[model samples]
Target: MQNSILLTGATGFVGGAILNRLHHEKKHSVVAVIRGDSHLQMQNVPTVRIGTFDSDTQWKENLVGSDVIIHSAARVHVMNDTEANPLAAFRKVNVEGTLNLARQAAASGVRRFIFISSIKVNGEGTTLGTAYNADDAPAPVDPYGISKMEAEQGLRKLAEETTMEVVIIRPVLVYGPGVKANFLSMMRWLNKGIPLPFGAIYNSRSLVALDNLVDLVLTCINHPAAANQTFLVSDGEDLSTTELLSKMANALHKPARLIPVPCWVLQGGAALLGKNGLSQRLCGSLRVDITKTRNLLGWTPPVSVDEALAATALHFQEHQ
Candidate 1:
């Protein structure tokens, strides 16, 4: 049956990819909800402009006739937020805004709600060999993660009280074309043949490609088994920092000029440079075990890491 789908964040990086995927499939009618008129123009997809997520904005009209709602719009993590209360700022959008949308969607007869969360809901990093799984207790250490955890709780409660099915997905670092922030910085540095000091770092991390994440989101849209379940998704292959940089260099067709620096030295230097968090991210282990995601959904990441990296590099080269 052709389903009427409501997709939020249709203009952002990951959301745009999801929108393209759905458009190409041509199996569902999509209504994109954007904050303003600045949205992608598609041939048949209609758009609704909702200014903000406060109480005054009415989402019911948009929710009507929508069988599924993919809630991807959120106030993402601000690395250097100057707000007096960062947690409150995040909760205003990520928590309250999300619940508001879910409530309206439930009331409007939406059958399913898919929420994209972060693996930071688990913690910052993991031990050397251990990987984070779905069963791990949530240990959010930052404002953004706390808000996501709160949103997940609120959605689960709503599901218990209503008929709408909620599926929560916690994905690790997602990378692909159009990716910005630290990932983009790293790619640019690699493209310029900058010698990085992560050659000796031996920490493993799991990451999901944009295409893989979109595939998983589509799976949860109507899959009966995905109802009321929390999933941890990744590329199913883990890599160390050194290995990752090397692979990225290969994809960029450049030499991986890396200098071997002691882990302690790297951490100390980062602290002195006011980038301690960056150091942890570069030299820490954070792996996610996707055994549950695989066994339950019978799904696998369609793109390999090498292929995804190559695509990303090619896009960067062309855009630059």
Candidate 2:
């Protein structure tokens, strides 16, 4: 049974990976939705061009004969957001735009809608001994997290009102071959053998490999238990800042040049530099318990962290 899947953010990291996975699996028919023209070539997959995604963006013409909707596109969280009314700006795209698409998908008789949400919806950070689960009450702190929380709320309401099965997946920091931002930056610093101040940081954090996340998305597509379920996903292993850096260095065949600076000193420096949030990321603990995800979906991350890190390092080396 081939399901016609309408995929948004097809040009993005997660969505593009999903598209490639679907293509290799040779199972489903995919329709890649892009905000503009793309040069991405696929054998039989077709592309749908649309304008800015918003409350009023027309999706009817593109929704025809679509069985599933994978909504992975959103206004990502950034450093030092300068947008006035950041929440409103995020809502216009994440909440309003997402709900708008879900509303239209329901009306158009789309069977399932897979939403890629963030773990920030849980909260900023947790202690090393505790972990966030799907049933935990949401405590979004930032505009992006708040928007995603609102979007999830709206989607749950729409699912109850309609027959569309909604699957919400909250993933921790994602990393893989084409990862960018902080993860990539850390890799670059490691490759150059730069001394980092994360040696004394014992904070535990969870991560999901790109392949693992894509596998989970594919699982939720046809799984009956996935309907109306919110799942927290990770690699099922937590790593401290020092452990992570060493692993990255090992993958890159570089020496881990980490200095054991006191955590207090780093926090104090961050405070002076107005990088408190950055400091928290480098020093705070954030973990997600994916027990429910595995029990319900009968799935586990197939890619080991070491394997994924090696692939990421190889890609970085080739490109550099």
What TM-score against the true fold does each predicted structure earn? Answer: 0.98, 0.98
Q: lDDT values of the candidates?
A: 0.91, 0.93
Clashes per candidate (backbone, < 3 Å): 0, 0
Error of 2 at 252 (Å): 0.3
List candidate 1 segments past 4 Å from native: 41-43
State the lDDT of candidate 1 residue by residue for 1-320, as single tens digits.
67889999888887888898999998888887778667685667788878886535678778878999998888898789999999998999899999989998899999999999899899999999899998789999999999999999999999999999999999999999989999899888999999889899989999999999999999888788899999999989899999999999999999999999989999999999999899999999999999989999998999999999999999999999
For residues 111-186, could you state the per-residue lDDT of candidate 2 as single tens digits? 9999999999999999879999999999999999999999999999999999999999999999998899999999
Candidate with maximal lDDT: 2
| Total backbone clashes of candidate 1, pairs 3 or more residues apart or in separate chains | 0
